[model samples]
Structure formats: C-alpha cells, structure tokens
Target: MTPQEALFKYTLRLGDNALIQGHRLSEWCSKGPILEEDLALTNIALDNIGLAQAFLKYAADIEGKGKTEDDLAYKRPERQFYNHQITELPIGDFAVTIAKQLLISAFEVPLFSALSHSTDETIAGIAAKGVKESRYHFVHSRDWCYRLGEGTELSHSKLQQAIHDLWAYTGELFEMAEEDTILLVAGIAVDLEELRPLWKETVATVLTEATIQIPEDGTMHTGSRNGVHTEHLGHILAEMQYLQRAYPDATW
Candidate 1:
C-alpha cells in the first residue's frame, strides 16, 4: 500500500477503536456503581468519542472520499470494523469495564506517542493532538485499576479475574497486521511487534502495583487486525446503526 493508503487505514482503525469503545462506555451513563465513577466513565466515554470524531474526519480526508465519519461509523458492517475484540466486549462489571479501559488506553498511549512523529503530516497532526487525550485516558483508567485491585479482598479478586479473562484478547494488541506492515513501511506507524515487551512490562507493573496477578500461561487469543471481531460487535452495531437503519436519510 502507498503511504497515503496506509496512513488512512491506520487512522481509521484508531478512530473505530475509540468510537466503539466510547459507545460501549456510554452504557455506564446512568448505571455506574457510584456517582463519581459514573461521572468519570461518562467523561472518558465523551473524550474517546470526541477523539474518534477527529480521527474519522482526518481519515476520510486522507481517503479522498466524500464519506463522512457517520457513514464509516454507522454504515459499515461488523467485519469491516478494525477494532480489537476486547473493545467490543460487554462492560460486564464496573471492575472489568475499567480494567479493559486501562489495557486499551495503555496500548494506545505508546502507539500514539510514536505516531506523533509520522512523516505523513495529517497522521502526525492527529496523533500530536490525540496523544494528550490518550495520556489522560490512560491515567484515569490506570488509577481505577489500582483502586479496584488494591482495595478490599473482593475488589482484588474481581479485578484479577477481569485481567485474566481479558488477557487472551490482548495478544491482538501487539501483533502486526497488514495494516501495521503497510504503515510501518510508509514511516507512518509503529512496529507493533516491537511494542510487546513494553506493553507487557507496563501492564505487569500496573497490575503488580494494584495487587492483581498477571496471567502467566493462558492461551493468547487473536484475530482483530483482520477485522475478525467478537460476537459483541454485532450487538453493538445493532444499537449503533439503529438510527441510520430505521431512517436511511435521518439527520440529527
């Protein structure tokens, strides 16, 4: 793929990941375990969606296509979305939800940090702005990971389960896909295979600090970069695509 194409694909994945996760996070709008947590999750959800919109806009521009962000977001089928399986998983309990958020944002920080220096002007610009937001999201999610993992015995156990249950899906986070190859060749993306050790180190340290045990020997599940998504994405799309589906030309 050409540099332009590679950059476009990379950015869209970034956008789709953020958007779908934001949508899932929104489910906590009124149902959080506490008022502060409800507000915090809501804030993070809004931030993620805002970042997605910025990324989607830039991605569409790079594609040189007239498709709007909504078209890519609402009109695309499940298999076309490039988000990892973990992002599409149900929020489950508050602890699990926060745990996944921490994991994703942790991965995102380094990815965006690296992207901030891309040769592609548009991609770099987006990443420069995005890295800051990602940093904030990382901090927020990590704090909760620590709180839940280090708190009462029940919180610690639940947090540990959340980490292990989600660990298999994490293999998808560091594997380079066609998209990664394309972008890395173009000087517009990180070499994800190289990010694995850092990812493991940072995640393990955070888990250690939280008093959560890292999963050592679980089978590593994969297949997100190729657009193979989990079952939850279908359900997520059912809700996300509803307005556009119900009224093809509907506008807000």
Candidate 2:
C-alpha cells in the first residue's frame, strides 16, 4: 500500500478504537458505582469521542473521499471497522470495565507519547493532545484496579476474574500488521512491539501493588486489525449507527 493509504488506515484504526471504546464507556453514563464515578466515566467517554473526531476528520481528509467524521463513524459496516476486539467487548460488571480500561489506557499512554513525534504532522498533533488525556485514563483505571483488587473478598475475586478474562485480548494490542510496518519505517507510526514491554511493566507493577496475580499467558485472541471482531461489535454498530442509518442527513 502507498504511504498515504497506510496512514489513512492507521488513522482509522486509531479513531475506531476511541469511538467504539467511548461508546462502551458511555454505557455506564448513569450506571457508575457513585455520582462522582459516573461523571468521571462520562467525561472520559467524551474525551475518547473527541479524540475520535480529530483522528477521523484527518483520515477523511487523507482519503479525499469527502466523507465526514460522522459518516466514517456511523455509516460504516461492521466488517469495515478496525477497532481492537477488547475495545468492543461488553462492559460486563464494574470490575470488568475497569479491567478493560486499565489494559487499554496503559497501552495508549506510551503509544501516544511516542506518536507525538510522528513524521506526519496531523498524527503528531493529535498524539500530543491525546497524551495528557490517556495518562489520566491510565491513572484512573489503575487506581480502581487497586481499589477493587485489594478491597474485600468479593471485590478481589471479581477483579481477579476480570483480569483473567481480559488477558487473552491484550496480546492483540501489540500485534503489528503490514500497514503498521509501513508507517513504522516512515517514522509516522509507533512500533507496537516496542510498546509491549513498557505496557507489560506498567500493568505488572499495578497488579503487584493490588496483590493480584498476573494470569498466565495463553492463546491470544486477535483479528480486529483485519476487521474481524467478536460478536459484540455488530451490536455496537447497530446501536451507534441507528440514527444515521434510519434518517440519513436528518439534523437537529
């Protein structure tokens, strides 16, 4: 693929991850454990959505297809989406949500930090802005991991199980594709393989502090990069695209 094509696909991958994960977190809008926590999750959701808009707008511009960010987000079929499978999974319980957030945020923190220096100006700018937000996301999720993991017997057990269930999906976060390799050689994308060791260190430190054992690595679930996803993504698209699909061009 051409560098432009690689960059466009890379941008879409970044935006889709934020868009889908934001929607999942928005599911907790009024369902957080407490009012403050509820607002926190909602605010984080907004952050992700805002990030999505930035990346997708740039992607649309790169594609020269005249598609707006909304079109790319709400009009795409499920197979066209490129978000990580972990991002689209059902939120499950509170512990599960935190587990997902912890895993994703940890990756983004370092990923964006490196991307801030990307040879592509737009990507660098977006990463610079995103680094701060992702850091907060990492901290928030990490704190909660500790809170639940060390709190009570039930809380500890649930958090541990959440970690166990989510571990299989973490490997995909570091899985590189040809598009990624292209950008990597051009200095326009992160080397996810490099980020993996740092991500593991950050997560392992937190898990140790929480007195939680890291699950043994098993077969890693993947395919999101190639547009294959868990069954959950279809449901996400059905709901997220409903308004646009049902009433094209209708506006407030």
Best by TM-score: 2
Q: Highest lDDT: give the candidate number.
A: 2
Q: Which stretches of candidate 2 lie over 4 Å from their true place?
A: none
TM-scores of the candidates are 0.94, 0.99
Error of 1 at 38 (Å): 1.3
Clash tally, candidates in order: 0, 0
Poorest 10 consecutive residues by lDDT, candidate 2: 243-252
List residue ranges in candidate 1 displaced over 4 A. 1-4
Query: Cα deviation of 12 in candidate 2 (Å)?
Result: 0.2
Residues 1-252, candidate 2: write the lDDT tens digits. Answer: 898888888999999999999999999998999999999999999999999999999999999988999889989899889999999999999999999999999999999999999999999999999999999999999999989989999999999999999999999999899899999999999999999999999999999999889998899999988899999999999999999999997678
* Pairs in steric clash, model 2: none
Count steric clashes of candidate 1.
Answer: 0
